[model samples]
Target: MQRFAITHAALFTVDPQDRVIPDGTVLVEDGRIVAVGPAESIEIPADTVVIDSGGKRAVLPGLVDAHSHSSLMRGVTENMPLMEWLPYYQLEHRALTEEDAYHSARLCYLEALKGGTTCVMDMFRFMDRCADAAGELGLRVNLAPYVADQPGKDFFSTREENKRLIRTHHGSQSGRIQVWMGLEHLFYCSEDAYRDAVRCQQDYGVRIHTHACEQREEEDAVLKHFGRRSIGMLDHYGLLGEKTLLAHCVWLDDDEIKRLADTGTSIAHCPISNAKLASGVARTPDMLAAGINLGLGTDGPVCNNSLDLFEEMKFASLIQKATRLDARALPADQVLRMATIGGAKALGLDGEIGSIEIGKKADLVMLDLGAPNLTPHEVTHAGGNLLWNLVFAARGSNVTHVWVDGRCLIEEGRSTQVDEGHVVATAQTCGLSLYERCRALDHLRVDMI
Candidate 1:
């Protein structure tokens, strides 16, 4: 019967009404939010540990990274498009040993926690290690071990490995970690593999995750191979549905968008990665208008270079506005929702997490409003600029505390579960060794020595 109370904070409940309680309190019991309302309205029990915020902390649902990858390639690859980048990325995957996989997940998850991402949907290789790291670190996660069956795609996790991961890790970690069916990509799979993915979904009650329409050339490539466009081919294979999450629909037609909306398929939009790879800007406004369930994703560490949802939120809005030439497109409030509840919806976990509401899981992030960048938040009154500053101006450095399942994993901007210094030191050694082992140092932008 663990119990706690967080009081005198500005609560951004991204609920059905979009409620923002200026001075609120939330009560937690057994990892669930038992009560939430204005500070004056809630009664704190004597047995509960109280966290008084002094009315200078802004609390919101922990940001959901709808798409991510556990990798050691941050700052290791650059200026390569999706197709051209695959070989180099595959090289690293081939060189990665099991120990390297664990360290990579540690580094990536540490970064994610420091940046206020409490839940993540990660699709990458050697994901059993990733699952172990997530369970130890206390973040909610969905692991999708990258799976493929085509001859050239043997570098990815096989279907057998995917099944093993599902059986071993799904619903593990006290229901905090879930394993999904991860298909590497539409082009990377044979019809047999697609059918097997569908079978995994039906048999295990898990969802399918894959990249689709990421590059401008993908439409033609998928059409040439399957005799149908990317979305159409997915539909033909019975892949588009509520239980499927597609990453980066950057080149979809209006009809395809309609098909996605009709099927209730979700999309994870990784704007920074898309721009980094020079993939064309996705028609985000069009997708939103078509009622698609879309959310923000930071992609892999190498592609995004960071997992901070704050940066992703700003870019997610600005890119849409700039590309659509409409200043009102993807405004601050909507982008914030996309990072929070919308992301949970995309991952099919909205009911449990994503908002500071009664009965929801007590997964929350608290930012110090006293930070120089957040100085003028003044969230105690209406017309406060807190929400606007949060999306447009605040950085991950402002995050002071992070809680998942009523347990504080990061307090006062430092982790309580693992030694950050050790994680960084080990990751540096592992990364350099991996690059050297693969003879990839020569491929770096500058000479090593």
Candidate 2:
């Protein structure tokens, strides 16, 4: 049954007791979420398909960036850091093609599906044209093809091409895509490619994304080439457990934050690409008081020039209260549960798509609570301030609708699948022909800092 529902909204059920519900509703069917609360208690049946949103709309749970990268070299590599921006991003990722990685994954999955972000984790380079541009723009991806095996970063992606992109796009589109198992740091691999990417994450049960201790000279060049430090050389090659997933540990220590909360390893905290490449801040409230599992990333629209997870949940809570000057560091309901269910438990996909509850998978988004900076949308059971105006005055142009498994690929504000002005004029003509092939391979470094 294809059902639907969504009624007079205002929800924000980042559940497990974080419920917010005003007039709420929900429902959905074949795409999961059997029903949520309010609207005078559930029951909107009689052959579904409703969508009322008259409570001015707020909804929630969709976000989840968890680390990204499907580059188009935004604003042309300004200033620089992270080792002088990796040779101008490996010479514009070696002048990409495969139709410029399918129009840079259709301009970063159409700016992460018009910014309400319904799941990402991208890690790049021709990801089977970023899984056919997230199966032609519906979002919920994982891909992760940037695998590298050292020796001058052998132009990334390998480990038998990340096991043929996990046997050709793991759980393909109907499951909204996922592939994982990628590595591009800890000195770009080799300890037999980190034991063959932790034996390709136990031969494809999937999971293992990379980049750790994101700076402090990449943990002092992985502690002078493997005397251990990028999380103790990724826990000395067994690649520290719970199906791995790092990405800017931002130079940890406190025994690498208790070895990533003792191997339940997960962290994608890319606070504005580590404060726009000066690369330093992530100890996300001491890795969430050492229990770890933090999430919220906006790491690449070419170093976050923008794939707005509501400006990465308002700079992941004003850079943890301006670097822990502590006006209640990382609050706003724990940075909106680290951008929706701790970014679907940092990409393991939290029992199938972060919160809204019921049986899950309905994805969601909504927003536009009569815009004007979300008017005075109340419902934090009345004390209001609507989760601090959706983590400090929401954006992504107040989203205005977007669904995932239940379909509505963005509504009141465009895209019911494609043609967002011919995907931003074909990513501005393949980002000006990969910026004149990185200024004819001199890697266009317009020295400015």
Candidate 3:
């Protein structure tokens, strides 16, 4: 087993205790954290590879993206509401080939690593190809194939296909990659599909992920379909459980919030995507107060246009404050926790990978503070100020290194495993072809109208 030591750096554990160790050293042996303490206390082994951070960096647990689509549709659909956006997104999704999915996964993973996100829960079509790309790129991915079945058969996967994917890819990538049962939305799926999704989750011991209450239209559709709201309907169908991770509870009411808290369900809050789509701000402060485990997510490259969780954290904090008209809504430390420990809790990986504790996997990110935005530092309120700077000032460019399971996948602000140039070229070509196809379909729709 290989051994490595990262020494003489500032460390933010984001643990339950919220410990920040100045001039800390973390020792990793065979992909697990063996020791973490002040640099003066820990003895460096002669055979260990030492990473000298020169006290110019702040190391923290790698950021976890609790929800994402991993599609190359960044900046594609715009100025549309949920109902209109759904059909347009579907038209574009139908244009995705296996190669397109692969390249998109590569591109998304590259962006994620560069932005200091080490783990992601990605829901997309053609997930086998996505899984392959994540495996090759050494990304810690939880892959959920989009499963939707409706009466019209416009764009969705059937129940049988969802089961097949779960069987094939669960625990596939040496335990680095996991597959979950997914649905695009409750309205897009039949009652039988919902039941089968729950059954698959029980049988395979994996999580169920889906979008719920993203917009008022979604809520109205659920009410029209079942004479009840989406959360109540999901509860009636046995879909509300501890293993469920619901994305975007922006339109949910107090009753829905109570239901989620009572059922121990998790939420992936995407403030940036919500704002960009003109979706209402999620009541994250209320949800957190109600004991809901809230994690940060970028939603998708298409809607969010970037996978930077630091930006998401900043947006999450500012939006909550602005919406509530209360400055104390989401503080810097709370936002930092939401990006690290809160995300791990929502993903059900809290026991293994959230903080820099001994016996935990060494998934870490190093941010260089030598830049202009981070100078004139002060140690008093350092944790709070460090988090504020990270959320408000830092970008993907500030992330110097990223490690997952003690393996260096990103070094010096670049992906070590994937070819950035080739991935970008392929995504560009595929995106152009998709645009042309959508234009042709628009003409057909116009003629029909």
Candidate 4:
């Protein structure tokens, strides 16, 4: 319940207009923003903590990771196809124990928070422990325990187990930690599992998260088996809705795009992961044009190898431009929205935490504008267009501080919750030990060709 008055910041409000206020002031009290605007317009209380941005610093809304997985296998799954890559890395990583998941989740949150991400939509196995880790670290997390009943692909929890988890952690930690229904993929789940996804949402009023049209082969397989494309198939099962968050709609067609828009479904585009796997570029321009809410994701650390949304934001713009042969296909402003407001909208958390405004949760990030990478050029009439510098040049290392719900989780580029040294050490040990245990399996033992 700390009160603070943040002032003298080069603020990027990221509202509907993406207003850049030269010197702005934000008043935060009890984990919510009381006022936000030019310093001349707001009154400051003498007793509040005054965080003055004396040096070159920019304040913006905390970045959101629309989709991610808490796994410690970064740099291990390289150049594998989408289908093969899943079982090869993810299934093998599922051997994680409660402690392993805890450490892994801690590492994930550590990196993401340091990189200025305050919220994450994570689909991982053994997520009760994952929820605990997120709650402990103070990052807003949406947990969807992976659920699938197919024989060979059954690497998820049961409906009953997920319900128990929902009861245990859904609204815990002041609603900062939540649970949703997750089907790993339409291909991985049985029809019964699909029905159960609806039942979970209907019974518990939770969101449904799953993977959709990620690769051509996946779409082909779905068409052969279900006589419909990805969106249409999911729609048939009543799985596509306002709360449905589908990841990697890379191979969708025109009609499917319309279906997504019509169903009020959202997309979490993982540009780096798709490009790394040689998966085709998603129809992002069309999806946006069709009124679909699209957000950015890092997929899994093992696939993209990093959770830096700054990196994801750059790739999200460049890939669309290259694919469409239109340099203006995806602009910096749109990409920034995808990482911030659009991400909140996609998760249905928009009313609470996306942009900087009065009454919203005080989730914010501050960047060192003096960083060498952000210097020289890109200056507009008003100082510099930070949206351009942030997306094009600034790296995660440029993040100076981060706050979620008015709590400063990271300050001066260091995590305050867990010791980075210990978290890194524990993750390294867990990863090595987990890799050793899984090496006996044929999937882990096989070398990718």
Candidate 5:
């Protein structure tokens, strides 16, 4: 077993009690945390490699992006709502080759690692290639193939493809890559597709991920088609459960919120995407109060434009406060929890990887505080101010190192497994090609509109 020791750093466990241990030391053995406590208290074994944090960096559990679409369509669908955005994104997605999908996955993982995100639940096309890219890059990924069984040629994967991906990639990459049942929308899928999706979940014993109540049009469409709201429609179809990670609940009503809480469903609240697309803010604060498990997500590259959870955290807090007109709406500590432990709970990986506890997976990230943005650091409230500075001001550039499963995937802000230059170039080429296709489609749509 490989033994490593990270010493002399401030630790933010983000546990239920939110423990912050200054002058901390963490011991890792065989990709699991063996001990976490003050430096003077934890014993150092003889063969352990020591990484001296020098008390200048804050060590925290790595962030989890509960929802993401690893597409090459960043900045392509700006100023469009969900209905228009969906078709536009579909046009872009239909142009993605297997190589393009791989590049997009690489780009997503690189951006995620740089932003202190160690794990991501990615819903996208060409999921096998996405899983391959993630496996090569050493990132923990839950790959969900976008499933849409509608009659449109723009729709990519069918229920058949979704099941095939699950059977082939359920536990691929030595258990690092997990496959889940994905749906483009509740409306896009036929009743048979929904039944098969449910079976897919049971057959693979994996979770179901899909967009829900993202916009008013989605709610109206669900009501028009099924004579019920999205949440209620899902419940009526027997789709509500603990294993479901609904992407957006922005248009849910009070009863919908109650239904979500009662059914033990998890939510991936994409504040950045919701705000960007003019989709009303999800009642995250209300959902949390109603006992719904809420986690922060960056939605998709086309909508959110990036997979940076740090920006999501800040936006999650600020958007709620601004909408609610209360400065204490979503506090810094709460937002931090949403990024780490809350996300883990949503994904049902809370006990395994959320916090820095003994016997847990050592998925960790280090943030450098020596920069000018974090000046005047004082432990007045045992790093409360530090947490504030990190969530409110810090960016991906402040992330120094990232470790997943006790293995260092990123060191000195660089991915160890892949060439960053090559990955960026490939993604850029794919993005440009997709953009041109989208532009052509837009011109064709102008006549129809």
Candidate 6:
């Protein structure tokens, strides 16, 4: 059996009450946490491999990124209208081979692990290859192929492609990979496609994920096509439920919010992607008040330029405060919950991965609080809340080490599963090849990177 232990760190359990143990120890064996408590209380087991934290690190439940796309589109999709951005950005994805998809997923997992994210829900194409790459890299992932039936936007081979993907790869890799049904969007999918998606979920017992109310033109097109608002149409078509995870939900009124709440649908709020696409501010404060489950997301690498949940955390709070003209719009604790527990709940993995509870999988991140920006955060006894520092000050760079499934995938700022230089160089080479093959140089805000 395998064994691991980390001691002498500030443990933010992020449990129900947001418990923080200043001098804590966590013991693991065979991929499960055996004990977690104040350091003096928990005995170190024999033959355990101990990880040193230098007494100034904070041990947190690994950050959960609820929505992402494994794409090489960073810096190329900026400053375009949402409608224009889709074809310019996503269409070129068709040019990638299975090898390209593997490299893309590898790079995405590499960046996410470095940024302290242990779990991700990504929707894209070539999902089998992506699943294999994630399995090899040791990050827990939920993947699906983008399914749509629009005249020019069929991202999957057939309407039943996600079904095939689920049968072949879902729940594979010792449960590290879970597959879901991904609809491109309500606007892009026909009524038959939507019905089929619901049927697929019922048959396979997998969750349904898709975009909704994201683009500025999306609501108008949805109304024109379906004779109702976006959320209303989802409700009418029997698509709203606890098993549904919607990506954007940026444009919702009171009734639509009620519809979502009534159906128990979860939302993945992408603050950076909304701003980058000019998709406008979501009714986030209202959504939270309505008792909806909202989680933070980075969308895609090209759109946000980074898969840093720390960046998403800051924006998730700051945007709400600014949009509502209330300095108290979203408090520090609530935003922190959105990044951790909220994401777990959204992805329906809460029982196993969200908090630093004993009997849970050992997915954790250790951040060096001694870092410059995280300084003045010595201790809560000194009147500083590191929880707030985590939201407003911490960056992805502060992550010193990461553990997923009790395995050390990122150690001291480097990936253990991949050669960092080779991964970066390969992604760079693939990006250029994709651009050239897709003839995508015309869709740029800057002439050059």
Residue pairs clashing in model 1 are none
TM-scores of all predicted structures = 0.96, 0.36, 0.96, 0.96, 0.96, 0.95
lDDT of 2 by residue, 169-288 (tens): 898888788887887775566778778878878877888888877778667766776677778767878888777888878778788798779889988888888888898787788889
Q: On residues 378-427, what C-alpha lDDT tens digit does candidate 4 reach at each position?
A: 43324366668888887889999999999999999998887789889989
- Lowest-lDDT window of 10 residues in candidate 4? 440-449
lDDT at position 125, candidate 1: 80
- What's the C-alpha lDDT at position 110 in model 4? 90
Error of 5 at 329 (Å): 0.9
Lowest-lDDT window of 10 residues in candidate 5? 440-449
Which stretches of model 4 miss by more than 4 angstroms? Answer: 377-383, 443-449
Model 6 TM-score, all chains together: 0.95
lDDT of 1 by residue, 288-307 (tens): 99999998999979798999
**Tens digits of per-residue lDDT for model 6 on 240-320?**
999999999988988889879888999999998898889988888799899889988999797889999999999988988
Q: Report the C-alpha lDDT of model 5 over 1-449, residue by residue, as the tens digit.
A: 89999998889888767888878899999999999888999999999999998879889899999999887777766887777766666665556677778888889888998889988999888888988888877878998888877665444677778788887888877677888888777767776777777877787798888888888876887788788888877787678899888998898788888989999999999999998888888888899999998888998677888788888889899988898999999888888898998898888789888789998899999988798887766543256588788789888888989999898988988888889898898788877876776676664331101
RMSD, one per candidate, in order: 3.2, 18.6, 2.1, 2.2, 2.0, 3.2
Runs of candidate 2 with Cα error greater than 4 angstroms are 4-10, 13-21, 27-45, 49-59, 62-158, 161-163, 170-175, 184-209, 215-218, 222-246, 249-267, 270-319, 328-334, 341-361, 364-449
Best by lDDT: 1
Which regions of candidate 1 fall more than 4 Å away from where they truly are? 380-383, 440-449
Better of 1 and 6 by lDDT: 1
The candidate 3 region of ten consecutive residues with least summed lDDT is 440-449
Clashing pairs in 3: none
Q: The CA-based lDDT of model 4 is what?
A: 0.85
